[model samples]
Target: MKMKPLGRTGVMVSDLCLGTMTFGTQTSETGGHRQMDMALAAGINFVDAAEMYPVNPISKETVGRTEEILGNWNASNAARRGDYVLATKHSGAGFSHARDGAPISGQTIPQAIEGSLRRLQTDYIDLYQFHWPNRGSYMFRQNWDYDPSGGDRDEVVANMQECLEALQAQVEKGNIRAFGLSNESAWGTAQWVRLADETGAPRVASVQNEYSMLCRHFDTDMAELSAHEDVGLLAFSPLAAGFLTGKYQGGSVPEGSRMSLVPEMGGRKSDRVFDAVAAYLEIADKHGLDPVHMALSWCRSRPFMTSAIFGATDEAQLQRILDGKDLELSQDVLKEINLAHRAHPMPY
Candidate 1:
């Protein structure tokens, strides 16, 4: 429940961000509200959501339901509107259910913001993020077939500039306080930063990407960019979609778990992922630590981390993670974790 600066935006955020992706799907509206209250009471001030959320099985039916839930909470909690930093995303192209399969572009920015604001029932968003780059991204298990050759540099930069202009308009209108990116690469982030600095638009304040014990892609180039560029990492799936929690370590998919619902685990299902989990679990056991706490605490230990985003289906799970919010791994434990990473790099 510690606060950190969000890039160069001067916005302060909690070290742990409560993710509401399961709000309308696995979690009921009441449950989601309770979770938010608990998170705020625990000193967590950052909450992240998206337009296309509640994704155990993302359908057209539930496309904007997550935002609506938060909106409802906001309507009732009018007095505490400014208590937390609220963030959400506009889905990129190929999200067929939203905007009829529209890609993120300057043309869509205004409309997207209007829709999100209406659904969120709020006047402004603390941080607004692009769900993905129109030029495509290597995150979400797409790294294996990642082909960056298709994007024309000029076209991509132009798009970012256009989007920045639109974002600047929103900022002027008091619609959003800061801007961010998701599922983006170091190169994509660089372009956004360059355009922002050159044009004096709202600089990219954060990048929300998948980062966990098994996924170390950000450890090198992205880490350097974050450290020097002042762009903090809003690490989604910091627990590896729950794999780092050890619930799926032995192929035991409990009934309501993400694996049981989506069996594929978003392409995270692999023998190697379990092998990686085992290695980390070993470190946790050796140090007499809860694997879930160990994984989250490990993320908290990273200097470039703005927040580690996590989701929970129920209060119990949420509290378990909250219990570990302040747990810090010792130097010895971190050394062993680094060794584990070297032993099992990119298991999925």
Candidate 2:
């Protein structure tokens, strides 16, 4: 439960952030509220949600339900609203349920913030993030053949400037305290930082991207950017979509598991994925560690990691993660993990 600075914003956040993607879907409102209580008790002061959530099967019907559940908790705990840091995202283009798939622009920033504020029952968001680049992103396993050749450079910069101007207005109006990016690249983040600095808009405080033992995309360029630029990574999917938990090993898709609900595991399933999972599982076994703890601890060990965002479908699962909240990997375990990474990189 160590606290880390949310970039240079001077806001301290827990090393682990409570993720509420499954709220209002896999979890009941009572369960979601209980998990928040448990997280607060565990010293997790940061909670992350998106306007488009409850996404086992993201749809128009369930859009914004997760935020509504969080709002309910906020209403019930009005006195403790300041007890935690609240962060949420604006869904990018192609998210059909929000604004008919409109790309993020100056006009959309205030509208999105207003919706999130109303749904969250909060005056200001601690960290407001763009769910993804409107131009497109390589996150969610889209990096394999990602091409940036089609993008218009001038148009992209212009849009970023416009968005920054709008974000600056929101900051003055007390709509959001800080701004962030998600599923963004090193170059994209660099532009945001540059623009924010030049315009005095809220400097990009953090970048939320998927990072785990099985996924090492952030280990290179983005790692360098985060380290040098102070844009700490709020890593999502640190468990590799539960693959690192070893529940999907030997083709065993347990009932109610993510794999069972979404067979492809968001395109993370592959022959090499299982092989890579086995390797990490062996490392955990050899060290007498719970694989879930190992995966989460590994994420916490990274220099660029600000927080590892984790979600649980129920209180029992959330308790298991909280029980291992303070497990730190020894040098020997870390050395072995490095070796495993070299042996099997990018399994998906």
Determine which window of 10 residues in candidate 1 has minimal summed lDDT: 151-160
Cα lDDT of model 2 by residue, 109-216, tens digit: 999999999999988999999999988889888889899888889999999999999999999999999999999999999999998888887899999999999888
Compute each candidate's TM-score over C-alphas.
Answer: 0.99, 0.99
Which residues of candidate 1, in runs, are more than 4 Å off? none
Q: Which residue pairs come into collision in candidate 2?
A: none
Q: Model 1 reaches what TM-score against the true structure? A: 0.99
> Candidate 1's C-alpha lDDT?
0.92
User: lDDT, candidate 1, residue 302?
Assistant: 90
Best by lDDT: 2
Count of clashes, each model: 1, 0
